[model samples]
Target: MKNQNIKVRKHYLLKMAFLALPFTFAACDTEDMLNPVPETSISDKNAFDTPERIIGQVNGLYDAMKDGQYYGGRIVVYNEIRGEEWINRLTNGVTGLQTWQQNVQSGTNEVQNLWGAAYAAINRINVFLQGLEDNKAKIDPTLYTQYQAEAKFLRAVAYHSLVTLYAKPYNADNGASPGLPLRLQAETTTANNDLARSTVAKVYEQILKDLNDAEAGLPLTYGSAVLNTTRAHKNTAIAMKTRVYLHMGNYAKVVSEAQKIVSGTTSFTAPTGVAHALQADVALPFTNYTTTESVFSMPMSDLDAPGTQNQLGYYFNAAPVGNGEYYLNAAGIVNDAQWPATDARKVNFIVTASGNKYLKKFSKPSPFTDYVPVIRYSEVLLNYAEAAARTNDMPKAIALVSAVRKRSDAAYVFPATSFATQQALVDAILKERRIELLGEGFRAMDITRTLQTFPEKTGSGLNAPAVAPSSTDYVWPMPNSELATNKAL
Candidate 1:
């Protein structure tokens, strides 16, 4: 057994001495971006050194991800609000709802928060990589390799998120769009602060490179199987690759990569020797600890609770258990004829009180310490199904999609004749993604990739004079803060 001390070890990076130099930091403390690390006191002497601390730095990277700004909530909440699967009564000062209804300009808080939070995490990962490289001679080769792989995986995740929110979808003009500043090296000097945006193609190229290394480097297991799902492992990198390939519209790669985690030639069975599988009771872990379906989940210790103000539960759950600022879009799911009323998701994943239908997927009472799902097995299945359908593997696509559907409810299972063409199968797979992964921050990307129109929300107490995927409002404007700081953007 792995030492419990190592498996459960947690570190708070923001509270500790961060990359003591701005050269390794993504952005220096400026008037606009968060100066999360007080650079004034940071120095080489205070930065992470000893080999044992490398693991701590790795854990610190998780702390950066645990921020409600990213996995803690906003990422998922923002993605859902932008899609038709949710509704909000926005006049009650719900900026979350307004993110979709009103075209938030470059100056909006959403742009700033999402951009700032993501880079902050990226910078931390960069520092971890730099530190790991420097101390490689002192650390065990096995452990050092794991640390390096996990750090790169986290960095890739951050960049993938950055590009997804700031630039158009990868297929958009084949990634000709401007992407976020791709800072591969650790930033330490002011000269590197005002970097320019890279082409979306270049950003994705780097993301894939990192994930590829992670896939090759991360160990098959992290000793503790439960923690394996929370930390970077071989499957973590593979699952994330599936997501990246899906976003890039690389159907064949998506199918091939997903197959490594899921048993193929057999449709939906979890692969032998792989830990991931569809949870028998899908809702159990959302309120508890890590589970098999989770490839990588954000583990937030009690002391490091994803702060109350921006937590996902606050946005989706009701007052007694949450903020209840939003509710499930009845027309999208509850009343949609395509979705069976008796599905396990509705019976266990949602809650209704005083005539209000709310999604309780992220609900974990006030402190909301529930582990956040980053990439899960079912999603990989959906990705594989979509890719397989598009690549002419009809039986595989139909079986893959049906596996997920039947897991929730046999009644919703697809009929053999349900899809007659590749497009029909793809459409059904996409719908399954919507049903299975709602409120997990996928709707926006799916909409952008598929060029689906915004749902035109009703009762949001907000107005949109205009909305379109091709419009500037579709993706976040480089936040005014970044624009003012990085002139090249």
Candidate 2:
């Protein structure tokens, strides 16, 4: 069954490839790839008349989301380049340690690939939403709402990620902060090429609105076993809200959302009949796709699949069978020791050999496995801790932190003398996040957002040497292709 899904995904990718070429050639300038369609010819009379058709269209959006160009490849590349983990393999011979801080004029494939892929997903989501609306009455109203909510969530997520990486952080005091171009409709013609950037706050407002609508419409849980882990549920919506709130520095909202999941008081329930817990046998959580820990994951299958497979382990692990892109060294291991020795979460998740520690989060030997997680349960606990500490609920914060720590048999108690203030506690939580969530495509966002909240770092080691926005190193420049086409940057 999983193999069938892989084949379907490959077929969808082929269709997208063929569909994208005309647009790709038409634009000439790659940056115009994300322009919104002023008018879509797709009408409500013909789409979603059958269950099979609607399902296929929805599946296409998921396939686009998993494209190596998007989450599978360049998105991870952007995350790694900005973070402390694996340095650019191409820059190894270069002298400067700050090679990642290069200007957008560098025109690296990594940058172009990321920009193109994000727009591609946005385009796909736009098409799906248009189809669903056109055939609203022809489809089951419940399924129609669910599919629309899902596409909206995906679109909002893609846009949010693009704005964060492509533009500056949102400043409430400054209404002029540049944000990514807002592309809400599906473009099918050449006239939609002209586009302009929106403000950061405006972009975030759209993201929040989509999430709110999705939470209200999505089911508490998926009805089918095959769909539960693979599809977004009410809890997934809540989990994403927690993350978005955290980035926005809304501690009260973060705490409210996270606590709902952490205590199992809300719509979220651990996958029934799955007794999966944080395993004590290994240092890191196993990359098992069926685990209860996953809030949502893209399902992959087939050892010879066509699309991007689970190559995270293959790329990061030490030599022999693995590609030695960023082999762990002594310094890497020492920096990673932030994970306590007794924490089994650290052992199985990271491979320590030859004095280097390789990330083993997705250790499956097969090359063709689906591997993208938008959110996970472990992140929920961390969110609760950070938000509680920020809100002056030290006891609640410590308890949440300890719940995760105790799972791995690591030290669950924080000394009362360790942090005298809420700010200090927040620092500890951030450090824990860096080590725990490394290589999961979050370090860069965390770094940028943290610097925004705590400008002063006299005591907090996390911010002692901060990366400033004005510094070329803080943000990746607009891709040269994008700059050339839009000319707005």
Candidate 3:
């Protein structure tokens, strides 16, 4: 958004920086990707001079991604608030009041911050990729390919997140609508800042290309559980493809990509690559972030947190556990008769305080350090099930949906009438998504991708009117920072 490069200053390429470094690079403001000061920064010239420095650069890419403004927290909070499930309890301007009310403008702080953070991470990836190639002879060929694939995967993630929020849905007019500026090359200076927006289709093409290359080059499985959960691997790329394809309304492609790792219809387990499958308890992944079910997550620690007022726990949990900025909407899926109170999801993740219900998925106390899930195996199964149902694979769809649902509600069974018609079965699967993925940030994406209106939300003296697909507010506007800095908008 700043039309500038993302540069790291002192101590960024530390050997022990595994997750994030908002503290160590406080002077450099590493999280502010749009405004990097080169005068006192560590030049990319020596970034890859040694193997340790190269590995640090790889970790740096992830640090950019987990900035509080991006995946570390706000992205999840914004997506959930923009949907119908959550109610504004505080109406705090710094938080997502405008977004939850569907009145966000180009100048909105959240809008500009998210846009800048995403591009900041993207520029860092580009810079890393170019440096890796320039210094290929110094590094092992296998490590070079692996690092390149990791950069590409991260780039794909950043681009996809930006497109979903700032551009029209891929399903909208088949992605013919205008998209964000596709900044692929490294931006070490302000010279290359005036690129025009590409079509949504073109942007998606690049995203898919990056993901394909990432899948081919990334390892099948990292040696450790933490690495498998936090880093991009072959299954991570494939799982991301299912999400991307589903967004484009490419059900066939979703199934095709999903089938590579999803081995069985009934059990629904990944046949290879870390042996991903549904955890016996839906709460296990939240408590134990490195569980096999967690395909990809951004890890946090006491030392490196998502920052004050930015953690998911701060927004959702009631006082004592969180700031209680927003509470669950009583009229939302929480009250759905289909999602029984006995369900494991309800029992483990929900809590009531002073007659108000709150989502406790990210329930970590102050300086919330809960890992944020990027994608999970259950979601993969659900995505595959949706694609299968849309493509007339009724049995496969039924089996997959049942697996996800029964995992949380083992005694529950799908009513015979729920599968009587294709529409009925599809509707059932959609509801399951709402129930299963509730506060995990799928609501806005699911609603928009399918061209459904944002359902009206009312409670806690706050009201957000339903936003139809035809409305300008359905998708966020390009940030004012971008308009101010980039000549092309």
Reference-based TM-score of each model: 0.89, 0.80, 0.92
Give the Å shift of residue 1 in candidate 1.
Answer: 60
Q: Which ten residues in a row have the lowest lDDT in candidate 3?
A: 7-16
Question: Residue 366's C-alpha lDDT in candidate 1?
Answer: 73
301: Cα error in model 3, Å: 0.1
lDDT-sorted candidate list, best first: 3, 1, 2
Residue-wise lDDT of candidate 3 within 1-489, one digit each (tens)?
Answer: 222322211121221122222223423345455765453234455567778778888998998999998999999989899998889988799999999999999889999888877887887788788788889998899989999999999999999998998889988799999998999987655567678999999999999999999999999999899999999999999999999999999999999999998987568778888899999989999999999999999999999999988898999888898998888888888898899998999999899987888998888899899998999999999999999999999999999999999998889988888899888888999999998897788889889998999999898887899999999999999876677656777
Best by TM-score: 3
Clashing pairs in 3: none
State the lDDT of candidate 2 residue by residue for 319-411, as single tens digits.
Answer: 554544453333332255445665665665667655556666655554635356566677777887898898899878776666666666555
Off by over 4 Å in 3: 1-42
The per-candidate count of clashes, in order, stands at 9, 10, 0
Candidate 1, lDDT over the whole model: 0.74
What lDDT does the true structure give each of the candidates? Answer: 0.74, 0.61, 0.86
Candidate achieving the largest lDDT:
3
Better of 1 and 3 by TM-score: 3
